[model samples]
Target chain A: IEYVEEAVEAVDKDKWKGIAVYVDHIDGVIHPVTYELIGKARELAKKINHPVYAIMMGHHIGSQCEELLHYEVDKVFVYDKEELDRFKMEPYTKAFEDFVENIKPTAILMGATPVGRQLAPRLAARLKTGLTADCTILDINENTDLVQIRPAFGGNIMAQILTPNHRPQMATVRYKVMDAPERKDAAQGEIIRCNIDSKELASKVSVLDIIAKEKEQFIEASEVLVVAGRGIKKEEDLAMLKELAELLGGQIACTRPVMEAGWLEAKRQVGLSGRTVRPKLIITCGVSGSVQFTAGMNNSEQIIAINKDENAPIFKAAHYCLVGDLYDIIPNLISQIKAGKTVSA
Target chain B: MNILVCIKQVPDSNKVEVDPVTGVLKRNGVESKMNPYDLYAIETALRIKEKLGGSITALTMGPNQAAGVIREAFAMGVDHGVLISDRKFGGADVLATSYTISQGIKKSGTYDLILCGKQTTDGDTAQVGPEVAEWLGIPSLSNVSKVTELKAGSMVVEMDMTHEIEIAEIEYPCLLAVDKDIFIPRLPSFVKKQETKDREIRVITLADLEDREEKHYGLNGSPTQVQRIFPPEVNNHREVWNGEGSELTGRLLSKLKELKFA
Candidate 1:
């Protein structure tokens, strides 16, 4: 094994540094979480009188850098290279490691997507720093420490973590937990293309083939969701829920049990372990809300729950709770919508 | 091929309570069980061992009571158990925890492969497996959904990268964080449990590590500090409607219209 010296010693301990938001993108299209973190970094940076930097790395991603310039970031660091076209762990870690050694940012924020979760920890370990993962909230203290808050212990508790003694305090914030800033028409930030060392781009792991899974709508981006719970009897019953979902121009989501039952794909599971969604409207059927399940969708604009048990925990998180069998309530509701009976506004 | 499977013990229930005043988890009476995800890792290791004719060792880092999980692994057919428990190793975040585990792995005998669950139920970071691999300077893969082939010197597996599944060949002396449902974990055999009940669980402490630096073992080694922990704020103000199905459906339509959801 080739022993690479730790990069922590290379950090300039006393240098004043800004907040860096890792700009995550695929095929040159930026992830919305990047903008959300930019908004958050801007908020935390202002208190400490520091600038916000967006770090973008990909193949032929200059246009995305141009797009990032309108979001009030002070500077954009671009690492455009063929080695970065795919999200290989080693090259991405090396590029970011070089960036951290050079800039010595006080803190780094990344989306808790698969790529970000993988990369953030590797960088943190290489730099001998700390990272809090899947953070739902971010704030700054008087000592310039970044406060990272996220659900812990199966969403029953919230932990407030701080990397007080580390440079570039790192965290992977969950997507859709924060609001993305509105993009301004006028571009303002400077873009600087960074160079990566050739040796740093070498990796031992190689991808043999890429198989795209069957296309399914991502529940995170859906505006409306019809969620099924354990109360749904069997696999065939999911079709009824799907009909209701389609009639309402929405998609279907479910709890862990429903997903585990193979009635729906794993992507449709909404909970601490699954996708965190903030849809405009969410109607849950026969779902007893656990903290794990509610933690993911409590931020929806409108929550209406239908369950037979009056004391089901889902009521606490719902704005409107209906106590009735979903088997009875759903078919009637579907028929009402099918009959074109519009309630007067 | 020798395999090392990393497992953890977590609260049996997700409803573990927190002390409002102390901001600490009230784990006094709550039962602990093997983390649900770790079963998949153990099962994967057992499957690989069964095919390749080798031994499997289960390792965990926690209090003395955590050795229970190690014993549970034995019932599932693990050959050996190692527990890294020390008061100094308390209150570790991911970096320190991974570092400590890496050191423990070094102290234990070398293995051709290491397996870990995608994440633990209590922490749910999914970061430790890769971080430990980074500390060991070995190639690591996470979200492994299927193990296609196990060779003498290497293994081929498919990784679920969310957008796409990529098949990759990783050499031995590497680590893999297997996702759930890669294989259904078998039930603990009562026969195996009675046979291995007295198997010794090797314990490693800070004194046993090659790196004797006290500053790198526990809370002192951890860079992240918990400012506070509190119960999640739950919104309890809700309009409860109970009525006949026909009337409730009509009322729900009106409510949806009021909210402009229809």
Candidate 2:
């Protein structure tokens, strides 16, 4: 049919080759999300019969390029320079844009981290291509189009999107949403060293300093999490929730509203705009369960949502749901844990 | 210095009723409000204007009713308002939306700074602000949690980069997509709303833009297409229990033990 003819002519499948994943590195340490992207890229590459390439950029990142070869990437492109020591929007975008313009990869994937979020849009604009943000699922269609699936409308709906006409279709995938590929001791790949022009490093914005967040409670590292939401009413009520989390031997986290209320640190907020956590167990207290907040913790192994409203959407995602006043339930649970009176199953 | 803040009109998340039969979003009666995050952007602009002494303009793109958000911005003390709306601009994605706004901004008067929300409740792409900045050829900073120093030519701000907070300085004529809680947003004033009721909102269509190519205005210019949209699959298997505090706690603990969590 004419539709088939148009589809065939629309994409020159032979022109687009290789799936490139950007390895986000900082302070000589590679983020785990890079490995996850590598694993995902390898899988997608297998489907479309394309090579997987990992692109890295940083000062003194030559030694790091070899480490990327241990993953499933067929080739690694490293852009090393002194001016690239700090993370600037201009230089980073320039490096990637220049590389894409030359190599013309089929697709580019990045972590939905802070740097990725800022860099992806600008680079996509410069390339005149499409970029999907915070994608939870990615796939390749028959036409070799990158199927980017993401939650939209405050997480009320899932929208499947495709960039049919653009080259090097780009997307930023959320961390911990995909499995990190295991490292091989004797893996093999090609490492290409790219030269960067100093002029390209010039940036309108300059980083003054990177202040490390104080490591008080690392929720991402915790096995169990106790999260509070805006429904908790007052900041003082956080004491009870904290005590319950303590009794449960878990760290205390919160939704964006709780942190906005100054009840918790920004580090403790978990959502699309906050941190993505995959704890073994997460108990949400008084959370109305907006999609933004739930998207961050939906991957937890076990979920227990406690809210007074039974119809609250949080229940839809919970393995165990308790519809009751958190004030009435948390205190009792705390005392029971303290007394250790419950018989073990 | 003049400041322009970009706001968006989105369906109220709480009231987005879905058609049960078709599973399509029922947009007819759903109440529309200014994007929640844009309130933070407006607050940031207001604070900067208060300290630096500048005029503030609020801009948006949508149907004529989207002028409602501009009016709301006026209620919050914006000096002026502009709405870019046209039938040709319908079904625009983030790329086309940002491009259209950038064109509208170019047609409008000049400003030293542009502000936008981190993301919209509907599109939630968080890309339009930076893309608009790219079109304007201005430096942009995203996830800006704190505005530290505002100078005559340059500004220093702290951006939440997830694991670390990086303080960065960008010269004037830059854009910032401020994160939430930059400042507690002030409530819209009824007095200002009454005074600004008759104020004219500048409306620009595709014809008004410098680039009048119809192909670059709406779905024709959009790079991505929505193949499908549906309500997320919900897990309806849930057990509800009503009991005294201690009894409910025991039941929950026992269930946790059964699930091997204990």
The candidate scoring highest on lDDT is 1
Candidate maximizing DockQ: 1
lDDT (Cα, tens digit) per residue for candidate 1, span A234-267: 8888888998888776899999999988889999
* Candidates 1 onward: DockQ, in order: 0.42, 0.37
RMSD for all candidates, in order, please. Answer: 8.1, 8.6
- Residues B7-77 of candidate 1 have per-residue lDDT tens digits of 99998987878887877778888899999999999999999988988899999999999999999999999
Model 2 achieves a DockQ score of 0.37
lDDT (Cα, tens digit) per residue for candidate 2, span A103-181 = 8799999998888888889888888778988888999976679999998876677878999888889999977778777
User: Which candidate leads in TM-score?
Assistant: 1
Q: Which stretches of candidate 1 lie over 4 Å from their true place?
A: A1-16, A215-224, A227-250, A253-281, A284-302, A305-317, A320-345, B239-262
Instruction: Note the clash tally of each candidate.
Output: 0, 0
What's the CA error at residue A221 for candidate 2, in Å? 14
**Tens digit per residue, CA lDDT, model 2, B1-262:** 7999999999876435556776666788778999999999999999998898979999999999999999999999999999999988888888888899999999988989999999998888899988999989899999999999998899999998766889999998999999998898999999999999999999999889999987776777778888777776754556777666667788877765454344
Shift in Å, residue B84, candidate 1:
1.1
